[model samples]
Target: MSGTAHKADVRSGGQPGSVAVISSHVARGAVGNRAAVFAIETLGHPVIAVPTVLLPWHPGHGPATRIVHDNRQFAGFMADLAHGPFAGEIDAVLSGYLGDADQAAAIAASVAALRSVRPDLVYACDPVIGDESGLYVSGQVARAIAGTLVPVADLATPNRFELAWLSGRVLEDNEAIIDAARALGPPAVLVTSAFAAQPGMTGNLLVLRETAHLAEHAAFDRAPNGTGDLTAALFLAHLVNGRGHLEALRRATASVHDVLANTRARGADELTLAADAALLSEPVSDIDVRSVGRRSEDITIGG
Candidate 1:
């Protein structure tokens, strides 16, 4: 389904709190905006979705057409939203994959503009640069996000590889993840794919101002894309709903775990978010959350 089809199907109840989701849009799969928008809205938050690019499906599944908006037009579109009358309605902004490096500056500008009116706005930046396979995007695009967006983000959700790349170190353990997260400059950093204590589990290590937590769940084989996107959106949504940091982390992790398990059970190629929508609100997945204590001074900078 294209964004058009999604827009037609999703009908919010005119909710008060709305989230601005800026990412890619896939016609047939739930990857970027498709994943974030539905996850946010299902939790009762209205979504203002801005697509950085449009795709028929994720490139991982097969070759698909890519539709990137012209740089000037993209900037104008984002500017209109930022300066528009309803800009203040946005409670939070979650930015993901970018089509071009210039898009990072445009997003930063929009975030800044929104912050001027709503000083307490929560901006979560998901630097979707690459995974374990190394840098997937151009070095320029990665640098643009690191320079223009990451510094301003209230929260950053980066997988282990991304965190390692951003911090200029190899993160081999949770402690290293914590140290790098602290040095990364974001007030709060959610490091996904952190080392799991359990043999068959993976974790999301959340390092905040004064505390660190690890939320672990069973590791599924071949999990679909957009887990990070869904996790970031849900975590922010929970915070906006007044949940404490620990609660938000646990809930968000559980929701993603449940959704992934469901998707796998059905043998679906993409996340079955629509079928597992209820899990977003009432996730039944058992997430083991533990306090990992405060940051440690003994940090190892991996080679």
Candidate 2:
């Protein structure tokens, strides 16, 4: 941040509007890359997601269309980008779920390249790391994402646990979430699994700039993996379309909730957006933007 100048001003070809996502693509499972692709498509943006890791049950049991590559062979894939027509055809970038540090490095470099051509392009980083219990991603990969990838992103969506880990702060409740998000210095923050424990009251908090708003919703009985991907993509799309933070939160939350409800109704494992395509396109029956009021207490930063 010191001398980087933070300049993003470049133009590119190919539709003039698209989102390049950097994350792993699973061929067999409906997780990781498949979720990202679904969310990006729902937001009406073309996606360019490079495969970062390949597992055994891929190509046969995963999403209908998925990019598969060996984790050790990331360089070959990247080298292909440097010499192909894809070198300069990206409008924005949305990244999530890095399997290894090398993958994170590759993604960071690609993000830099995308910025070179699409300077005003919005970069959204979903720094996928650990959940509430413990770290699921390797420490090296987590460090690279927090240290390199996140700082360069214009918008970031990290869950409660990720926020705590990135900020090195203990966040037991809602207020602490805001404090932690502010510390990260990201302009907008969407804490996906926000839970407020104040007796009988329970809700999630969405913070933008320095303002935090709360919305009460029923938490899904089971943890759905792709909810974050959908939330980030929808939030970014709505924000770019001139929707405010709280409004975006409302839309995203409603959308995810509807997806979960549909999944539960069908007794499926994960929230199947494909089954419920309407939820993706029309997250909410109607978009309602309302004032959730200012924080009763201000977040104090120790300079």
Candidate 3:
């Protein structure tokens, strides 16, 4: 946004790729783009952010004033970014929390446009549709993401509930989650809040081909809302930096785990991402990451 020129091209690896981030923007909390843009930027990538919706704080806190740009305005904004000067530098795109069905189509078009310029542009879609509380968004918005965004995404990060909703299956077990993820059409699918064999933990399951990598961390009650947004952005940034899937998952999960712990320690309602900024770049790996079998039993331990 300043006079700074773009970093060296993504191919040369002189610097990490610039990312185009599309998500909801919250004025006061770390959710959606607020979480994503911070995480990506902290991971040492330039971010071009576009807000699909605006809110004073996370709606989960209570009732709040919000703004969802109509389809026309949002499309125009996305179009400008697609054709903007920095478009050529966007080697990756991370999208989450759509305002409406049309926003999904608009984001898909922009992703296509960016891919036309850079064929290798990675689009990571975090389908922020619902949670255990039931389908939070309108059915139409969820369907649009499942039909439009998920089809075009190179990678998809959906929590267990969203994956279940998208696949029209009851993913009561990790095997069902794996099957649903593979059938959902994304080359890589990371299911957050996945089933955990241990009663007190939760996992982020990364499914690729027949292999599944489960990154398990202690489950905290009443975790903040933006962990999904943060995880998606951090994982995308690590991949754009050329890290492999497992390493990316490990680091992102570790970072998120630390943040959640730190937030809970301070009795804070929001993620302390700003106060814990350095943790994003150098997160301590204290969680359990390992390969899992069809029944989700551990196969190989991560060293």
Query: Rank order by TM-score, top first?
Result: 3, 1, 2
Clashes of each: 2, 7, 0
How high is the lDDT of residue 157 in model 1?
Answer: 95
Model 1, 1-303: lDDT tens digits are 000101111225655567899999999988999999999898888899999989999878888788899999999999998999988787889999999999999999999999898777788999999999889789999999999999999889999999999999888788888999989998889999999987999999989766688888889978898898899988888887767667778899999999998899999999999999999998997676777845423322110
Model 2 C-alpha lDDT per residue in residues 1-303, reported as the tens digit of each score:
111112222345424355666666654445666777777666666667765655533322444443445555775566555346866655567788775777767776766765676566677888888787788778998999999888877777898889899999998877788877767876666777776444443354666654676654566656556777777877766655455556666777677777877888888766677887777656654433322324533322110
Q: Could you tell which candidate, 1 or 3, scores higher by lDDT?
A: 3
Tens-digit lDDT track of model 3 for 123-220: 89999999999987899999999999999988999999999999999998888999999899988899999988899999999987667889888899
Whole-model lDDT, model 3: 0.87
Better of 2 and 3 by lDDT: 3
Best by lDDT: 3
Clashing pairs in 3: none
Best by TM-score: 3
Q: Which RMSD values do the candidates have, in order?
A: 7.1, 6.3, 4.7
TM-score of each: 0.92, 0.79, 0.93
